[model samples]
Target: KLDDADLKKGLERSISTDIQFLIAGQNSDGGWGWWRGSESENWLTAYALLGLHEAREAGYAVPEDRLARATRFLERWLTRTAELQDNATLDTRAFILYALSESGNGDESRAVELFDRHTLLDTDGRAFLLMALDNAGEGQRPRVQTLASELTARAILSATGAHWEEQAPDLRAFDSSRRSTALVLRALVRVQPEHMLLPQSVRWLMIAREIGHWETTQETAWAILALTDYMRASGELKADFSYEVALNDKVVLSEKATADNLSDPVMLKVGIAELLLEEANELIITRVTPSEGQSGMGRLYYSAWLRYYLPVETLKARAQGISVARRYEAVDAATLESLGAAVSTAQVGDVVRVHLTVNAPNDLFYFTLEDPIPAGFEVMDPTLLTTSHAAEAPGRERLDPDDSPFWYDSWTQSVIRDEKVALFSDTLPRGTYEYSYLLRATVPGDYNVLPTFAYEHYYPEVYGRSEGSRFTITPTAATE
Candidate 1:
């Protein structure tokens, strides 16, 4: 299988694409971060490095500067003093150690010290660290060897349930997901290379059928990676191992699990190796030619993979990678009391939360405004803007005082785009603006403070879009 040139080409393309995508997210400070403009996560950076190194070894053209920056990213953090200072506390140290080991660099003194401190939790960080130590063998710090073995036992050993205080306890026996089980197996194999974990690991992957770590593709990939590693180490890579193997989002490797030699882990090992190799191969082989204008590495990959995996009819119906900007605008009707007591002018001398009623559906919608705000006035919580009645399609309920709308501080001038997406991206423009609400101000009588909101939606579907409200305030209030 290793001699197959076609397989190598596919693997090379798939891995190189993955690494390049990760590298594209590198920050100016030489660290990799998740999402846009967030603080750097050292563990992710290390994984990027390790992934890059693996791809390079597999014949991918990973740029040298990117790899150096990835490594230096961790080095800079390791030596710096901050929330990331204590190598013993951060999971990053484990990831860094793994990358260093994979790099075949000598004298990872700082990394070893961190592992010696037993900082790795029973998560991905711990599993990878143990594997790195095992790969390093006697050269690894004596303390790491001892601690890794102990931790591995804890992860793989079965229990009635999750017992935190017992020796050789299982942290996730209650977790019936393939993702958790895979992590447990990762740690276990690192501590005991050929140790048999078929009963539990198989149950985790096959029974629970949970390959997602809550919500991500990493769990499936990681679990398979661990199983393949175990099979290779145990010399079980000669038979056809069976499970679900997805080449793309459209395909899952749910082939028949070939009967294995009950006494031998060989058949399972061989079958998994094929899937791993094929999965990588299928990622690079494209059936559809993407137009040069397509954006996003993963998006393009998804398209290509779908072309190969999905039926021809479905591919024709699938929409290209075009994203539409959608919005929902809401307006509330005026009641007698709501309109009786009026707020003529909202001033800047208090802590405020805006709660304007709107008719909106269950989908996420953006709220755009043509107004500005005073300084110090900011939305305390844009996440829970819409009342619980939000999820009810179209229900009614009083909001908490915090949910009430008011001017907490004076605003100056700025363009504000309040992204009222239900996921709470917290991605608002960080500046002050003078707010000119069209809602309550709809009444002409001395700013008759409308009972609910007024409707000026960018899109017609936006009802109850105020689920996320926008506000502002000045540092200096009228009281000051």
Candidate 2:
């Protein structure tokens, strides 16, 4: 994120592209779904609206009419659900409150009512409620402070240190531990910076560095956001400080952080106008605290943000690099008529098919794609998958089948238990590729297919995901 003065000149193009993507994907009734190819939901719409509001605050030109329509959609949904005695989930209500308040669309009364009705006392739910009340600007500072303190009291201290748990005993527990900690930390930092819990949680975060880079996008984003906000709110420096910025191990700028300037973090900014940064280059920011002890090593606080400058040439090159697509299809063995890109219904023992395509600009040293077969669905002939590759350049060969894997390795078994089909390729040549697999429905109920992910070995940061899919299973053929 750039400063206010640099908003239009620095990140305007990228912000515009993201805003357009959200606008184009909005549902016709004015709500956005949690994922692509899904029906609108309350929580997802609120998240999208939150993102849109942030962009608008940064001076992006978001249509006022679109926001109005979205507000109407949320109001209607909430009113109808409440009338029908169908209470909204805590997560949905919290997000709706934050979104509506941030966007200046509605009051906080309904959200407060919904939150007071539920007493789950879970970490994620409680943290979100704290944030929702703070954002609502309802003069609930006392309530917010109390909630943060209560969360702090529930935290546990192991041999390692004090850290918050997910408290979600299901599949999400492992994946959400770091995320829950970050959310609670954010709430604490926002409401009561002077509380002792803030420093304890910060120390725990510093000690538990292994949980720093989580795999999921949301966890990583929240972690970064929480840490940055904490750093900014950490009050004045008690000791002398020196700050330095370097690019590729070469010093570019240095300054002393004294009581005069360090007292207010809002005025701090490190300009990089002269540095000619390129892709894949490292940037480092280091702050040094002098030791007051006789024999000791001084403390060093290092916080670095990736630096990327997108001029016309670099942008054009990125456009030609890589592309991937994944789709769900209902197939008919006899007629072969196109059923649809989405599967709506399935009976017991019915098989569902998935299609995947990838286009590579260069020979990929390693590539892998994985999808979780839903609980009620079983992979039919997991070994019966097929792959086809069209080489774009001569002498560029496909990966050897032996080096490729057909299913997920145990690496992620702790987080996900559903059987999934996977495809891996090493030394896959520059080409367009396609693959397909089958799964048989055995149980009877509604199920949502988790998102599929594609990863590149060399550039681990670069990845892609399929639009999430869902289908319903009936107990008998007559039910369908």
Best by TM-score: 2
Indicate which candidate wins on lDDT.
Answer: 2
Model 1 clash number: 40
Model 2, global lDDT: 0.61
Provide the TM-score for each candidate, comma-separated: 0.47, 0.51
For candidate 1, the lDDT comes to: 0.42
Residue ranges of candidate 1 with Cα displaced over 4 Å: 1-16, 36-39, 81-88, 119-125, 141-144, 156-180, 211-215, 240-401, 406-480
| Candidate 1 TM-score versus the reference | 0.47
- Which stretches in model 2 have alpha-carbon errors above 4 Å? 1-10, 34-37, 80-88, 159-161, 169-175, 206-212, 236-299, 302-480
On the 0 to 100 scale, the lDDT of residue 364 in model 2 is 55
**Model 2 lDDT tens row, 307-358:** 5554321222122245656566676754332366666577886666666666
RMSD, one per candidate, in order? 17.7, 17.7
Q: What is residue 230's positional error in candidate 1, in angstroms? A: 1.9
The clash count for each model shown is: 40, 0
